[model samples]
Target: MSERVVRPVGRGFLFLDSHPAGCAAVVRRMAAEVEPRTPERRTALVVGSSSGYGLAATIAGLARYGVDGIGVSFEKAATARRTATAGWYRTAETAALATELGRSWTFVNADAYADTTKDDVLDLIAGKLGKIDHLIYSVAAPRRVDPRNGETYQSALKAIGAPHTTKSLAFDDGVPVLQEVGIDVATDDEIAQTVKVMGGEDWARWITALQDRDLLEPGFSTVALTYIGSELTGPLYRQGSIGAAKADLEQTALNLAKDGVTAMTSVNGAAVTQASSAIPGIGLYVSLLHKVTALQTPVEQSIALWDQLTGETPLDLDDEGRIRLDRWELTDDVQSAVRAQWESATQDNIAEVADAAWFLAEVRRLYGFDVPGVDYTAETEVDVEWPTTA
Candidate 1:
């Protein structure tokens, strides 16, 4: 364990946060963690696995456990100012390294939301690996496009018709700024568009296609991450159009976590991924959770997520059958404390606001900035590769 380095190595390491680092550490476990669950080659697929917890999961799957995998990242691209996104380069580098272990890795630049890309995946799997033992869906997009209507979906961060303001931290500097952001009331068309994109329809389609192609091993467990935020974020998360989408995701999980593919189950992984950072006010939420988890909770995220997937105890976090990572921060006591603390953030009396400079800076650090050892100004060209024909 001491020799292990976290996945997506060197560039924007996963779970670099100050707490229960998720899959970053667990994937590094020995042959037992990554060894095939079946006699066939143990192949895995990661949808939206480019950044955040998804990429971390990929690292755990490949770099750590020696399990080969195919990555499906939506929204993030390798072309960064004519180069690759840091996460892209990180993953590409990982695939390059895993080759030494004789474990294969490939990445597909596709929108997990689209059927065309879905077909591309089926073809990819059919041609090369022959079958899949596990599937991890970790893609989250704030906006969506309707395939049928050609409309765009933009989610609201505030209540419909409400103009709420809050204090925000700048990702670069550890400075707090007041933001007067409002929720953009989505049109009916916009709502439908968002639902179609973030909803479970695409996930369902992928599973059906894989099954038809005979790509799935019976009893193959499939997990799609979901978040049921505390009531504090109801307007933007749980009770909004996005909430409706999450409901769809949970429902989709129930339907998709079936087929008796021998082992099919979907896990609503507790929220802590690269995707979670982009949402307004969410950084604070994540940081607060991390800090609380770090301070009072014995459970760490990296161990929690991995254990839930392979634990002897009941894998479901709640009665809902969702595999909630045992994040003490997300529990009621911590959430209530954070909620009260959040309500305490005010321009007039900023003292009540939890001093989140450390947390905010750490969030920035997740994407390769302000980290202790990194030199951002240096011209470094990282190497990356796409899996060949496989």
Candidate 2:
């Protein structure tokens, strides 16, 4: 038996197999919130369903809400030389869990921005699962190629109005150290392209496609993920180019509501995801957030957010019809404390002030590494077959 030597590299790493226990932790943490809840026996179409909130919702929807689902994600398959993307292994693990739970699902590894991907997902749902009751859109990409003209649009993470400077963390040989990073105002083209790539255009297209094919059932609700941070990070997040894209997304939600589909944006908390790591100052902000916040797992956060929508609260939205899952992080006291820490966050005190160990572990756990009780020394295969549809 040949033992695989998979482990975490500097910022992120891929473990060959999904940690069964880790997946269970996600399901278990959110199970109680769903037992006495309404919205039973549903079907969902998750656009970015391989990982993060999409993956978490799929597992919880099946385990707790009695919902069958189809997951659409763009992930690379494993090779002899290297492991597959973490999302691939997560899909395999989800398949096994679905079987144990007597649930049904199909995972499509394709580009979410492509029309055929939506067609393939709809075909699977229309054939085996029937009409979808809920749609979760959480796709994140740096570039989007138009399905019509094939024109490529790239997104930027720069502040929208002026140059913004902040303290950040960079790994130095596996050590978390503080660094100063500056984000400049994006050019007009950068802002426009960012909106094209990260904005609501692709989301609107998906909804239109589903409606045309009659894949959406009555009372169907769709949620697209967004983030707006405190004043400390607003220049780079809420007021940035991505913020412009999110504004477009919110407008799309209004248009979608007029189409008779309950569409809204879910503003999630600041947590480390595959998408956030590439942002300039998010790593440090996340690390510091732990100081004032309990720091729920991403899976836990997603399940809890979904629970709020189905719970007695009626998906409490601000005047904008956006679900505010960052309520815990946005409380006046929490914001004040975080702002205080952000101003005082210097390399001399980061180690003492922030929980670097927890942040790093969370990042590794996303890739199936650093999981408790997972035997990393065991012999594991490099490639595994993906689950196919009915």
Q: Which numbered prediction scores highest in TM-score against the true structure?
A: 2
Give the least accurate 10-residue stretch of model 2, judged by summed lDDT.
Answer: 11-20
After superposition, candidate 2 runs with Cα above 4 Å error: 1-3, 10-39, 308-313
lDDT of 2 by residue, 1-390 (tens): 223656554433224444333433433443444443344677888888777777767766766665678888888876665667777777777776677666778889999999888888788888988898889899898899999999999999999778998787776666778888889889999999999999999999999998999888878899998888877778888899989998999998998986668899988888877788777778788888897788765566676666764563467688888988788888898888887887887878887687777777777777666766667676565466687652
**CA lDDT of every candidate:** 0.56, 0.77
Please name the candidate that would achieve the greatest lDDT relative to the true structure. Answer: 2
At residue 351, give the lDDT of candidate 1. 24
Per-prediction TM-score: 0.76, 0.92
What is candidate 1's lDDT per residue for 1-390, written digit by digit as tens?
Answer: 111222222322233211112211222221223423222246788887666567666665554345566888753433322334545544554555567567777778777766677778878777767787778777777766655566666654433334334334333233555354455565566566566767777677777878887888655777776666666666666666676677787878777655574222233333434565555666556555554555321113323444445442456556776675644446678788777777666654432364466555545444444545444444444323444522
User: Candidate 2, 311: how far from true, in Å?
Assistant: 5.3
Candidate 2 lDDT: 0.77
